[model samples]
Target: MKKRFARFKSGWSLNRIFHDVTGALFAPLLISLPVWADAQPIQTLTIMEYRAHLNSDQPTVRGMIKFADLVSEGSNGRLAVTVSGATVPGSPEDQIKALQEGGPHAPDMMLLVTPALRHVEPEFEIMDLPFVVHSDRQAHELLDGPVGRELMSRLESHGLVGLAWWENGFRQITTSGKSFIHATDLTDRPVRVIPEPAFVETFKALGATVVSLPYPQLYQALKSGRAEAQDNFASQILVGHLYDVQSTMTVTNHSYSAIAVVANSAVWRRLSVRDRNVLQHAAIEAGRYERDLIREQAKTDSAELAHHGMTVHSLSPTELARMEAMTEPVRQQFFRSYDPKILDLYRHQIGTRWITR
Candidate 1:
């Protein structure tokens, strides 16, 4: 009986049995490791803009495309970027609504102007005040500097992440029949103004009958004689082929305009630290690219407009000063429309000597 028992014990070693049991328990986990070790699914982000594919030469669209490229490269294959320029129809306000709500309808990003935000937060009108900044450097510094940063910070509450500012250049007046070499040329003229109160008021202050119209309808308004003149940048004039219809270009620079690259704040916050860094760095780099490109393009467009037989007029220092003085009363309206605190900041930044109560 002892010999039989010894044979049975030798047949079943405890360590061998334990090894078999442990291996069986962990077999499923070990076999499933390849699934865990595989790369994660890629995430995609879309950028919607009013202009891009319309005229790929335009810096606003080109810079945004470059931004998309930088982000894709920076994120490796883990992230993908889709730039849909000129995708959304209607006014920029329409796309802006999608941004504020965020979802399938809202794109992950887009380029916008101050007025779009002004409608959401009236403090933005501070920047819209005519002749708020004198030089290109001043505009860049104001929009990229402390004031810009503060304005951008406020966007967080509005479900937007204001990344950086791109240039739309200065807003100049274009006339269909007369050249605007002097401020009086604008007086009583039927000039088309954007659908903003400041624009309406500025033209009204110039003694012109304001022809309020959406951007899309401006060229037709000029052709049909509903409007005789409009104020905007060179790119826009070229965008609408207005030189073909408009006879003169006045470099009044009555107001400044910008294109800000903003993202859906909720989506922005969900990005990983590395991803956020990549996106932010890309945005800043792209903004600089657009700003520099527009500087050269503005010069080229003016020359091209002259080639097209449209007279390009520059404002003399004296003329500009007179215009600024003429518009001073309208600038003061900021006190009644926006926060007095922001008005003080804008006045300080723009070096406007007039004090607002």
Candidate 2:
């Protein structure tokens, strides 16, 4: 027996024995190993994407499309976005609801006007106050500042994430028969206002019979003589072909119409940190693009309207002051409903002098 054991040990060396034992123990593990173990770990990540829907095909919607393109490029195919205009039918409120609830057809992001947002958060009405924001510069300053940031942050409670403030330019008046040369011109006139309380109150304060209507219905309303006058951005007037039905354009600049780029809160949270940053920066850049487009369009819209047989008029500084004064009660009524701190912040940002009351 000793002679047999010695011969076996000499033939089976320690290294060979250890190797055979390890191979037997690890044979299943080696076979069961994932394919990734033999190759480089997956360098290609799954692409993340989202969809955006805007209320109209205005400059803001174009900007949203630009934003989608930017997010895709900025994220290097890690994130993608697709944008469509006026995909949802009905009022802006309906669009907002679709944004709040997510689905296959519902949008992950939306470009909502400030007035529509007022229905969700009344503090948004501060941005819709007439003549409060004097120029594009003032509007940008206010919306890009602390007051605007606070207002945006407040949207979290409403299941929205305010990304940036785009614009519809300043609201101007268009009438079918008469030109708005003074605040009194709107008095007793049937003027179509957006379906927002502030708009209803502002027009009523100016002594006009306010007809609350959705934007899509305005041109037909005027053409059918159901409504005689309306206020909207010059781009909206040009795009909607309101000049075809309306005979006059008044550069009232009554309120700077701001469009908010908002994402659903749940959707926002689902994004990776890097992707959220990309989306946010893309939104801000696209908003700047939209504002520039609107402003440039404003410079020539009057001439275009004139070419279309619509006489365009501008309100004199004195007349604007008078109009603002006339709307003071409307402002006061809205002010009482706002958070004092937020109102004060807005007032402070716009300069106290601009606040008539």
Candidate 3:
């Protein structure tokens, strides 16, 4: 026994014994270290952005991309955003439906125009009303203030969470036959307007024979004489090559168009409060970037359109006033149809005197 004990002590010295004890004690912790390092798994989100023009320079598409980047970086890769464009099937309306359904195939978020949202919530039409918002600054004031918040809040009941208001710039008139010098110049012209009621009524009030055609069909319609004029943003005119078919562009700025960044309510609720906040802040920041891009592009587009041999005209103050007066009834009808509180909020933000009942 004495010989065996001496052999054991010689083989296992103090350092060896100490190292064995610590190694045994830390084995479980060392094995569990990886789990601790990845306590939170990364969440990947899908965003379906619909744009008639999906070019790399498209402001709204770029904005959506910026939003995705901001969300990913802000979350430190915890939230990953994958942006898919027109590749997603169906119209904007159909896409909204899919988003609401919420499945493996449904997108977590979508950017929808106000007109598309109008069917879900009619108050959305208020944004499309002619002459309601006169300038970019005024639009920003209305949307970034209480009026905008209230409008977005209405979507919550419909399983949507509105994050920010992006712009499509102001709508301008492009005509194939003649320059719209006076409100009456639009009279009896075959003008293509968005299928939205307000847009139809506004052009009708000016005496234009309004035609509602899908955006993709617009070029052919004008080319074939099926439609003579259309109202859209300068970017649309440039991107859609409307200048090729339409010879005149009038800077009507009749209506300010806004796109909403919305998320599926179910998806939004699943996110942590911290993650949601990150998305919200990112959306707003990216929206500002998009708006700046659109405004800058508008300035350049006018010159480009002129270069393309399309005459660009700015409506005289008198003609704009006449057009505004003609569309007043449409605005009133809208005011009467929607929630009074929303109307009041809009009036308050845009100046109560601007829209009197």
Candidate 4:
């Protein structure tokens, strides 16, 4: 049966196509599937924060706060958030699993940075391409437009469902040993890259030896000289306090690092449509709050990092062109491997928006 089903490329799996249909057809012959219990009094909602290592609140945390308030106000106090800062789960993957379980140890939603979710939803790497999105406004256009919705739909196939988009700001490249002024400057250096394939490809194309690592270990890798540079948003470097060890911050815009508020499908299916609407609105409110905080803080954060003796470099247009060219291969590779509709959607919409401008 597995072999036969594997032959049908692009065909919907029987289980997916007829989950309810089969249940109804077989009702007479078998016991019914267990119905989920009524939602417990929604006194508190838990959000897992990865902020134990950082001293100050990051944009992601700020977004969570806004989301909680929106939910409480929208639900009129029936739903409230219980923020479990670094207490709920250790890693993004662990947090995702916790949401899937949906019980005493579960969260109704988990905020995941793109890399962690990339394994489950690789097509999202569209935005992860180096220098693909140049500004906050461009990022917003992509996320809220048709391309973003098309990418979000892939979450269901991977067992997670996307609720709303949140910002983490654009990634900047930083190195302790050297400054990245040109694409060739990356040659022969071991750069710490997010574990996502697109990131790995981007670095490799620029002539760097890419090391795939999780976010939690990156600063140590730099401090110990095991790696020379890393890429992340300004908020992460500041909140994670990576500037203490790294000396140079380059405005690379290598990728857009955003968070997705996602729910496990099983948990979502049990909620009433009314509850779902509340969740959706809360998520949008949180996303807006996050975007505003990031846009307002990034320039200030860069200046502050410089005040602390970290050398900052904004690339010239020629150098920026070099960096952008390095990512073309990654773009081609991704489009080849991803769904054609997803590729076309992005091209058409992103192109249309560009032309109008």
Which model scores highest in TM-score?
A: 3
Best candidate, lDDT: 3
- Residue ranges of candidate 3 with Cα displaced over 4 Å: 1-39
After superposition, which runs of candidate 1 have C-alpha atoms over 4 Å from their true positions? 1-38, 352-354
lDDT of 2 by residue, 27-91 (tens): 11001112242243311111111112123234554575567667756876455554332244556
- Count: clashes, candidate 2: 0
RMSD values for the candidates in order, in angstroms, are: 19.4, 20.3, 17.6, 13.5
Name the candidate, 1 or 4, with the larger lDDT value.
1
Q: How many pairs in model 4 have backbone atoms within 3 A of each other, for residues 3 or more apart or on separate chains, i.e. clashes?
A: 1
In candidate 3, what are the lDDT values of residues 1-357, reduced to their tens digit? Answer: 000111123543221111111111111100011112236776777665555335545787668768877886688767766655433355657767877888876778888889888888888888899998888999898889988899899889989999999989899998887788898898898989888798899999999999987677789899999899999998888777888899999998999899899999999999999999999999999999999999999989999999999999899999999998998888888888898888888877777755666
Backbone N/Cα/C clashes per model: 0, 0, 0, 1
Quick one: ranking by lDDT, best first? 3, 1, 2, 4
lDDT of 4 at 202: 87
Q: Which ten residues in a row have the lowest lDDT in candidate 4?
A: 18-27
Off by over 4 Å in 2: 1-58, 354-357
| TM-score, prediction 3 | 0.87
lDDT of 4 by residue, 42-116 (tens): 544456443333311456655766776677668765665544344333555665666666786666677776766
Clashes by residue pair, model 4? 45-82
lDDT of 1 by residue, 149-263 (tens): 8788888888889888887878898998877877777888899999898899888888888999987678889988888999988888876778877999988777888777888
Per-candidate local distance difference test: 0.73, 0.72, 0.79, 0.70
- TM-score of each model, paired residue for residue: 0.85, 0.81, 0.87, 0.82
